[model samples]
Target: MATDELAGVQSVESVQSETTTKRYPVAPGVQLNVRSGPGTGYPVVKVLPTGVSVPINCQCPGTTVAGPYGTSNIWDNIANGQYVSDAYVRTGSDGYVAVRCG
Candidate 1:
């Protein structure tokens, strides 16, 4: 029982750590696009100039595309409601680097 409880706690901690906001820079000259939602289908909300460092709030799976980080579908939440493809940022993780957005 103790082991099971400890395992549960560890799982929660992992999830919490994944959700922790992380700072990342826009790939140089990418002029990354911000979307209202997590996909290209979503309207382009804004554009961030190159070298802008943003706080990644979370991430969710979105449209896949080849980018500075190679091909990926993960979209990162950079602001309150703004999202940009994780593929365009240099997170160094080709896989999901943050907890999926709810």
Candidate 2:
């Protein structure tokens, strides 16, 4: 997908909270591992399947990986404070695509 295709998924200022929830899909054939924290050192809490569009609440610093969105240390919070690297997420921006998860 084109880079701009992921742009404007949602505007950060549109929300009134410190963090916002937005939907993003798991890359095809990719089963994204959800972690308890922002890095590999954290426990794997869940595994997301391909074709699933989940609501990412926010993001936090983590290990960088070359994924569909290129390299980044950001991790997306899908639910229950679980994280998955933003590198694997096609979040449009090459950097922090969501508000930082505190």
* Candidate 2 vs. true structure, TM-score: 0.74
Pull out the clashing pairs in model 1: none
Q: Each candidate's root-mean-square deviation in Å?
A: 6.7, 11.0
Q: Write the per-residue lDDT of candidate 1 for residues 6-97, one digit (tens) a residue.
A: 99999999999876767888788889889998899999989998888877788899898788778888899988779998888888788877
List ranges where model 2 is wrong by over 4 Å: 1-20
Candidate 2 residue pairs that clash: none
Question: How accurate locally, in lDDT, is each candidate?
Answer: 0.86, 0.77
Positional deviation of residue 15's Cα in model 2 after best superposition, in angstroms: 14
Model 1 CA deviation exceeding 4 Å by range: 1-20
